[model samples]
Target: MTTTLRDAHGEALSTTDRSALAAYDHALDLFNGFRMDPVAVLAPVLERDPGFVSGQLLMAGMLLGSFDGQLFGMAKACVDAAAASLQKANERERSLLAAFGAWSNGDALRANQLLGRHLIDHPRDLLALQLAHLGDLFLGHSFMLRDRVARSLARWNADDKGYGYVLGMHAFGLEECNEYARAESVGRRACELQPHDSWAVHAVAHVCEMQGRVDDGIRWLKSTQRHWATDCGMAVHNHWHLALMQMASGDMDAALKLYDEAVAPAPEAIALNLNDASALLWRFQLRGVDVSGRWKALAARWRLQAAWGCSAFNDVHAVMALAAAGDEDASRAGMAAIAEAARLHGAHAWAVALPAGHGLQAFLAGQYARCAELLLPLLAASSPLGGSHAQRDLLHLTAIEAASRAGDRALVRAMGDERAARRLVGARPARTEDHVAA
Candidate 1:
């Protein structure tokens, strides 16, 4: 008689070693909490149980999800290794491996479709649910972000191991879809259930930011600092959110302090971290702040990632860093990379991001009218370029600033009025605070 192996969620495991499955479960918990690198946690386990298909898939999925083209080789290796063990994999495991392979090969659409189908069949698969939710997020499929988690909610309950993380994912989706009130409620509940869920903390921060609740956003992030600020992979980003709130409240000094201390304290090769750094610095530039030294340092880090044009979002930020640093040649090279990426990945979001990149360049060059012209048409279509609404607001902000600099007050006012209307809808009054202890 053979004993079946099951995970914490009662999902069957391919590996017979209960200890390996426990390690895998621990990795998933770390990932769900956004506390540490799950790949690091799974490395030794996979070495011991080379046939652990789910572990291999999780590693591959995380590497591909990093959006670092340099990691594609490593992700491909994981895919190849998983394929070798496919004979031992269960149905859900096979589907997950296939999805990871698709993502590694740059077929995100196919990958997402496979993950979605896998989730439908195995709704209890938290790993699949997370990968699919992140896919929706990277593709800017806001509806799917909300609905994907919603679809699996029936299969989950309070007693489920990763229920709070699911709610965190849903909260971000709702916030992306402009359901601010519900997003905040769900996000808050998620945090209550799992205090250390940084993604949930970040989701509520998004709600406050989008609704212009700067004070509330500051308070929310500051109050939750203990949960997310230490050992959480998303610390920089949550701090980025706090810095944005500080900027909105006319506290540029405080924002810069956060930038120097928390947001981009050092150069990192990670595209996501670099994106937050570049975006925050660019916001400072838009306000006529002197960030030249900072830009020079940031541009150096971005130079390390210049060859990886797999992500349009990352490419745009690279352009910002190079251009702001007065590296004209490197800036031009970054633009060429964007063009090349757009030409090759026409079906992807790169094409949508090309104009935005050019518009940002124009804004930097003092070609205000041209900047507005290039960016205004892209405001509505920018979602496919992959980022949250708050992140994409950089484009809108540049356009409005350009119109103002071009002496087009009417255009600026119209754009500002439109933005104000959207932000003010269903917005509650922000409670006053003496100071943000960020």
Candidate 2:
């Protein structure tokens, strides 16, 4: 690791000096540690390597991965750097990276366009095919993602790896459509194509979680996360997800430990801080955990801006925290920002989220009747317009709590009858280590 690879006379490396290298490594380490904002840690490196900004892409990825998109400003300049890097790379790689950058920055349309262009040239660019599939996944463009995967499957003669990507993506898509069996099968095939792939793992998690197979979700989480933990950045993200899972299973203390690890560091504006820290708080509040102090500290630096859709997501989570903590003024402020950046797609996005948020606030306030009223509509909508496993689980869980408190038999019956019947399943031919060497 110490030996120079680029040259002998040029300090044996890139970025002009070791200071920049140290900065980059520090940022990367923090990134791997907790998905915290890499922008803070990366600042020193960016200052030194202004001309070389490909590093910004990682910062954006950390942001996007966490679903807290308010840290885009810190990485805005880096987007240009990344774009420049893409231009400098080979046409195919550039196109793929460009699509990735767009997706990371919360612009699926741009990602779709870039992937589209790349597909025109290489028709079977595996990277483009995957990016296109993902762009559609997040953009509420299910048909587009499905169709692209279909074309890729046909064009590539259904290569197993490519099929894995398509099926993995479709696993989530089917989950969205309440086609749990289809979701499960596709997800399992994706895992078979390349065991240890994160998407494949996620698909499997969905299949298990939706079927109420907690043990299965736990096994998938354990194996997949144990492997990811070797890398600090990936492990950090894993912890974030793990925290949520633990809390979902009523392990608040365990979740808290994970949360502490997720955001114990000094605050930064980069990807690692933004994602890991912000997301930790959001999930805490979502789980009905009192994260008031975290919210206050986080809100101080949280501004509303659309640099990479970070502002919207961050603000939304912050709003949830404030509302739950009973800070009306602060909560309203947070909601104002979130309203603009709210995710609106699928038949139940607004119906589900709006009510769920209200019910959460009410639950926090001990207003069970209001909670039931608000959550009932969402529970009703969710079965028909399903979503990602975690998302749908959240919808049902909130409703369960609300209805149980309110003594609403109809709500209980609806969820049990409509949602429980639908289950997603996924599997792989065999377990393979080192398959996700990203």
Candidate 3:
């Protein structure tokens, strides 16, 4: 029932095999799931034809919906390819695409670096304006995200329905900084604007997770997974978050299974990072799992800080890896390296906190004394670490666990009692044991 192009005679030139069908299906699944790796997933088809508008839009949606660390190089490559194709995408489409690309690969500084000069020529150019706002948001500069969106909305509010996209994107950033009130308010607006909007829905999940509504967040994800199982981006990311939330809630069995089913099959970095990958090292430490040679592949991946590396947010795991390999010297040296990188880059977009890294190193080194001393200050400062309250909370909790190990009374109280207590929304008990769950 399959057909193939042939030469002048009628010989078969190529085959429409099952693999091709599966690849196309996979592409569609990626898109529907909200995984956001358009450049990576769609690269094959894209390389075959540059002016693939559908591919561009799919890629754009992935980029726009991005809530994790920036996929800078992949985005840049896609944008450059699309531009080279000269397909002349519409202004709104082009602007948002370029904005995500710059934000991802180029960084806020790079985006600002270009926007400053571009604004002089096209001051009110909506694309440039939107991107300027995005740069401001990430760089923690003075640019107003809502104000810019308001302007854009005023122009297209009536006819355009995608404004939810803008609001949802901003909501994710706000949630990252633990600005729950503002994030929730913005998220409500986004949801009202587009209830079915994947990004808007995802932003709300960030808020829920920050508020320690892990069950609610995971429930939402399960519902979303069912809704977007055919959707690639959403499926992978939703599974990633759900797995982490489960782990945090002490459902290790569920977490591990999800990791294998959802994360192992996917390439997102955060999935591995948040899911207690230290278990891999710990298993090796106990001589239970033969994870010795696993280091070469994983370390190589982490060293580049590429896709898998983004989730390498847990510096402790890195330390554990070095220590597990019988190289305490290597572990110390690696910490110094990451410490410098954190200072230089300042994990504003996707990293946890600098002190969290130090705290992780202490725990990895078994220097409970120093770990408590360093991380107590860190737990106090987690609110300002950026990204979202839940992430900061996780950082604090992780530190507190280390501090508790360090026998630091203050650190334990700060992370365990005070921190958890503050996360209470109602008359609920503060001691949820999320932090102390062995």
Please give the CA lDDT of all the candidate structures: 0.82, 0.51, 0.50
**Root mean square deviation (Cα) for candidate 2:** 10.4
lDDT by residue for model 2 (58-94), tens: 4544444444444444445556666665434434445
Q: Please rank every candidate by lDDT, starting with the best.
A: 1, 2, 3
Best by lDDT: 1
- Per-model clash counts, in order, read 0, 22, 16
Residue-wise C-alpha lDDT for candidate 1, range 342-420, written one tens digit per residue: 8887845787778887888888889999999998888778888888888888887777778877877777777766667
- Model 3 — TM-score against the truth? 0.61
- Estimate the TM-score of every prediction: 0.94, 0.61, 0.61
lDDT tens readout by residue for model 3, 226-292 = 4445444445545656765675566666765764665443344542342234433343222223556
Please estimate how well model 1 matches the true structure, expressed as its whole-model Cα lDDT: 0.82
Worst 10 residues of 2 by lDDT: 425-434
Q: What are the clashing pairs of model 1?
A: none
Q: Could you tell me the TM-score of candidate 2? A: 0.61
Residue 112 displacement (Å), model 3: 4.7
